[model samples]
Target: MRILLAAAGLVLVYAGIVSLVSPGEPAASPQPWGFGTGVAVRPPEVSLSGGLYFKTYLWARGGGGVLYLRCYVYSRYEGGTWLPTPEEYPVLGVYSVTVGRGPFTEGGALNLTLPLMGGCVPVATPSVDGLQLGSIKVLAPGANLAASRIGLYVAYAGGRLGEVTSFYGPGDLPPSPEDLSLPPGQAGVLLALARNITAGCGDVSCKVERIKEFLKGFTYDGTMDAPWPHIPPGVDPLMWFLQNKRGVCVHFATAFVMLARASGVHARLVVGYMSDGPVPTQWSLTAFSPHAWAEYYQPGVGWIGVEATPPMGVTPPAAPLPRETPTPVATTPEAPPASPGPYQWPSIGLGVFLPLAGVAAAALVGGALFKKRVVIAVGEALRVGAPRGFWVYVNRRRVGRAPVEIVFDKPGLYLVAAGPFVRVVRVVDYRSMAGRAFEKLLKKLKLPPSATPREVAERFPQYREVALLVEKLRFGLRANKEDYRRLKEMI
Candidate 1:
């Protein structure tokens, strides 16, 4: 009976080992871009969940208190959405331009180079200044350039000494029809608010100032609970913000643009980083520096920057050294793939199969050793005959006379004695104990009963260590008392 029970346990252990070590099926290939045929790719919805966008390195001498690095410009506002110009729009391309070589030396020149971090083309300075442009590459007419670095020369009027400033030069393009576009659903609300805010304002500048002052009343909160909150179905996001009076920089900037457009002004939304303060040579800007502001088109004066968002009072921490080094201008040949050798398959098979075979062999050897120890103990207990009328006792409970056979249904430490002989033995069924613990863990985590170790690890990364230990124990791998104790603590 003991041998039969041991054989059954071994079979269960072997089955678990095979299941745990078997390779899984290959994953399906990813879906192709734009889905299938004839499907229109939707533009990614804008997220105001602000995060680090990119880093900018600036070398400047003197400029205005604030420096702007412009990235994406949106002119079309539909409902509450701001859309950028089509990719087919024409853009000015420049190969290279040198500064400080010519006689033009009045205001300080800013030498700026930032990597192409995203899809948007970044301009270092406002294009209205007529600054020297350099190393600006464009792919075809309207396609964005896939360049490593974009370099630009910005000339700004000298202001305070020791003040390092960078500027965003949005190309000098006249306002398009899209700039004056207003939200269809919220047009009436926006126009009414714009009129009420700029009631006594005479000129465009006065109206813009009035709108900026009006926006200061709204609370500035960088943390957004949802991308578009308080917006009911069919209601515009801008309308919701106007009613709620709370949002981040994007909300403030969008509101200002809509109000300006409704008041018969050509205004657009600019997304970029705003850096200011005194720097002897250079300072670093990080993801925390991303901001959005408004730009209104003024006749003869060109596009003027407007700050409608209240002060966020956030200062970007100085970066630890430069994150990336400038790549050298060079081209290299691609290397050919290596050919598989004749013995590759056999070597790979041996490499994977050997470890599994070793684990099985070790498990069998350990089980045999334990069985031998049990046999020796049983022999000793039977050989020592009890006195006349003497009986056997296990934990103070009498079973029978001397030379009796004892079998434990559960695994644990036990005390056996008969007549003048006494013995202590520990019986452990590692596989069963591990199975129960793993099942309990799955229940605690609310995972399905069919959840595998790999799935559990992937789903709850915090339980990765426990999952690995359980996998080993479930497969009858060698685990000491300490290992089981640790597993219990983890679960």
Candidate 2:
């Protein structure tokens, strides 16, 4: 009875600890388009929720560094939202030579396999001479949306993948009015800020440079709330970012376009993935790689790409202030929104786990001491009987006669019988205990119960060693008990 009570107490303690630390399951986002497959047609509208999508693969032989996979280009800015002009030309049977200027330096072909997460098909090529559509049916220069499974025969120059720049030709029409449109209500402040940043700029190129430099000074924080969900309802996201000066790629790119347009430089917001490091022969791109940037039109050279977002971990110089004070614009009286600090998953886990760990250690140690006392008491009681032909059985398996000592390789409750006496003994292994606790941690992270060790490692790269240990135990492989002890203390 005493042994059973001790085991039950330990179980209850673990249950309470789990209840305290585990978080409710996160709500899953709706995915209208199938994941990891190509789509036949573009969707009418798409929403951004900042959730991760399926992975896409790209295979390329040549060129590297910030491969600009051109997707959608938004020319119109209505407040905080961007809209593309309604103009698409058919380029189904046209050869690459007849497009903008001719083919750029022929580099190699790039094969892209995309999942059906969004409407636009991202196309990256080294050719800056023309908008190479390959066999794609429709081409929207203003919006650049296309069907999936896009293939481009890229042409290279200086080992950099060229963007879709040829469409904005020297003799082509000027930028649309929509490209220069500023957000309502905040137009005055935006124009004033733009003029202030570009005070010494002599031409459009100089103004573009000034705007890019100013935005680079702001911090790049991806943990903040999505742009659409600004605090104090109905506040423009761009205005909020300008006030805070810290945001993700979208915030930085949108601000750049707005500032450039206000300064009479025709610019558009481009959404795509930026392959930052060295490009391997085959690259696997995840949803985490989605990025946004700005492009401004230069008369003779066409639209040139400008990276405004500061590189990760590089502290840029302080943003320049206006040389002279401008007229004040009336604003709301609401308090400024707070900046969301760096990613906090690691800190949050530590904060919740530390206290519970202390309590768990106490409970486990108490259980172990009580278990040792019970075992000694049972041995004494069995030895005094001194009956002939005495026998002992564990879990219905007959082991030996009197004074039997049995060993268990795993942790669990087992039935032991000695002659007429029968009792339940619970075996405990610290390694197994830690493994169960790790599983509970996985559940708190919203991973599926059957998630594989590899999947868990992918989600939390920091816990990779723990995942490997768990994998060994699950698959009946040889696992180091000492390794578990060291890792537990480290964690």
Candidate 3:
């Protein structure tokens, strides 16, 4: 036994050594989109142009499985750009990040990269500034969510903050609009250019192509320089971008949206992720994937992605042009208000097993911890006594409202809530009750021999829950009113 224990100790020591030497961040394999497989090192600039990927852990329906869903945002397209919606959608999440001043993407430093819990896509100012999502969670009735495989990306300047981004949630689908209207704007440097850019284009298709061609001259930059030394006070930034050819995806996308609008085509800036992976339904993103782009909406064609900034290392699959554009997936119109379908319980539909890839990454990245060895037997029924009403809570769900007994096949920490009272209980024989094993668990807790289990439980918070378990396993005693009374007194 001593030798076996020593061997186990040595194995633990080896594991600790390996963990210490490994990289702190999870690594990714070379992706089709251009993200390199490597351990990410923080970059010097927030606007370091280009893409990166991150890993994520996703759970659906409370760990039933992954809910295969496409998470993105939509807006009305007119004047060659996306129009902001009227309804303000509040992002629901626990934490928020701050930068120099506000939620602005270019807020700099602390505010540069923001972490998000995915329900819908966010609209960033410049088209290229996009998110490499770390976790994508879908919450529905009777399900759970989790994330894994976290990687870092160079998240930089895709501007525009506090704009309303909309999603098609649970509701009857709305009619697809064929066209949109342009907003009123002052005529300046942009008017003449817009006229010329769409001069010969009589149809929407031709006009859209011309705008894309005009913006092709622009370059992608992390910190895009102002197009010229001094801009006329009234000239729009998009006008300046046209005058100056150098900029990042954000610069190019912004230019496209404005220029398209100027040309009398319905247009809007669309924000979403740009990853090498064609379908994001199964994967997570990194900072490198946060991107902004332009979209010209066609009533029947929907919003098609316009590629203004050419990809640097990898080219992702492009949205087909208006004529050849494929219907975007998850156009699964929200279920109609009165349309009835067969009722069924929601099940886990992880489009793929993406989380399995992160197990090794998590082990290497997360530090080791002491694991308590336990032997539990299944099918062992513990007689639960409750004079008043009680509810047994295991893994966060209330199993039953108890006027009677609690039979558990799995052993772990449990809480029994009755009236305004609650007590923690532990059962030893739960998983596999094949053989009889007597344990001196109380002694391991280092309580004095004279210390009654009840007294130890009352005095020490840690032992309170395990007290019953120790007595049950060691002395073969069933929990009774005395155990209940003692626990109730301590609480």
Candidate 4:
């Protein structure tokens, strides 16, 4: 009884921690489309030019897996409020890249000197120069009214794939007109079913069961398959339905509304957080819960909810603890002593195992300690006049914002700074080419090679290191003359 109670207590503790650290199960309500996908690193440009352009450069790529890319642009008219730019209808053409096997193709630059005749229009200006994708809604396309919002963002800008060159003004935008329309019968049937479920299902427990029943009829194993048939990329519930039957509540809600409408049910999908837990205090990582469910109008219960998906399945990963009940594995017995050795401290195997165990423990502790130190150090650094609202670019790619200190694994010349402000620092200088040259110059001045420009400035703020370096190089006329002569001779 004691062991069982202890196990139960541990399980409860673990569940609570997970809920606190990550987001809880979604509430039965509507939510905005949280399209989370990796975008390619836009090539390094000194700055963005003011005009309409195709912001394409391979958004997401997975090994042998279908890639879904979500591009966000913030746009505004000069001297006007931020206008919501619509999402784009991307038409992809796969080609083979010569470097390796699979569909990798040589990409081209996004030229913007042509007429833009697509649905997309340029939101950038001299002062207002960004894309506004906040209100841009992306939904699964279908015949139903709800799915109608999931139309092509803008139409194709350039001509077909390779011939694509320039972009005109968000040229004559296309209308939300499609030939394949949904029939009234199908839409009505799905809406009716949704209304019935929303009206009847009262609580989370009841909704979970309802989802189980709904999905059981579709998938034999109750596990969904992938590559949803007849659905557009990134805008289809059918994609999740066909992919993994083992998705969480979001998958169920999406699929439920989609399938219902397909089967002649008048239903619309909604996205919102479930009112399960208390509201968060701040917009921290824990506050963002991408929840989704559906609601339909019923005669009896106003706008009722049909929770096609409830919270279930594997939980998101966070800080983990050891299992309450550790499973024992079979082990081999120690060998007998070969000879009568006097005063043997430990066997070879025991010595090896104990040291290794110590090392593993130390490693775990070291990692935690290191993380704590870094976080604290960064906090301190940020407080000391750390530039705010600056962009961070590494290897000519804008990866993050400032005040950020990025520790790169590979050593090379790394460009780090906030937007518009930049400093090129060498991550690793095993070659010692630049550093050695600078150090030698310092040594000739009877100073230690370790006295770098940054160090000197810290010691005496008035003597700007950059200015001093410039002066020193200026004084070394013979060396400079020799370098100039070499260059002149080469020319």
**Model 1 spans with C-alpha error above 4 angstroms:** 1-64, 87-117, 126-172, 223-235, 276-280, 283-288, 313-491
TM-score of each: 0.43, 0.44, 0.34, 0.22
Candidates 2 and 3 compared by lDDT, better number: 2
lDDT of 4 by residue, 1-491 (tens): 64455445445433432332222222223333322221111110110111111112111112221111211121211111112223321222112101112221211111111112122211111100111111112111210101112221222221212112111111112222111123333445445554565457654334434544766544322122321233334433334343545444444544554444343333343332222222222211111122334433222223234555533321122212111112111110122111223332322244323332333334333432011111111001111114566544332234444555443322333333343333434333121222234445445555442243433444556545442443233221111333333323322
Best by TM-score: 2
Query: Per-residue alpha-carbon lDDT of model 1 for 157-276, expressed as tens digits?
Result: 111111222233333446778889887777888899899998987788889889988888898654423323344666566766788887767788889999999898998886765554
Q: Which ten residues in a row have the lowest lDDT in candidate 3?
A: 106-115
Show where candidate 3 strays beyond 4 Å. 1-84, 88-186, 223-236, 276-288, 313-491
Candidate 4 least-lDDT 10 residues: 42-51
- Order the numbered candidates by TM-score, best leading: 2, 1, 3, 4
Q: Candidate 2 or 4, higher TM-score?
A: 2
What tens-digit string does per-residue lDDT give for candidate 2 at 444-465?
7875333445556667898778
Candidate 2's C-alpha runs over 4 A off are 1-57, 89-101, 106-109, 115-117, 125-173, 223-232, 280-288, 313-491
Q: Report how far off residue 461 is in candidate 4 (Å).
A: 45
Writing each residue's lDDT as its tens digit, candidate 3 over 1-491 gives 64454445445534432332221322222122112222221111111122211212111111122111222333443332333332322212211211111222211111111122121223222222221112222211111111111211112111111112111111111222322333345345556778988897787777777877777656654422231234345554444556677655555766776676667666555444443333222222112234556656544444454667756512433322112102111111222111123333322223211121122233333432221222222223433345345543222234455554444322344433333333444544320121111113325555422233444556776765655543442222132334434443433
- C-alpha root-mean-square deviation, candidate 1: 22.8
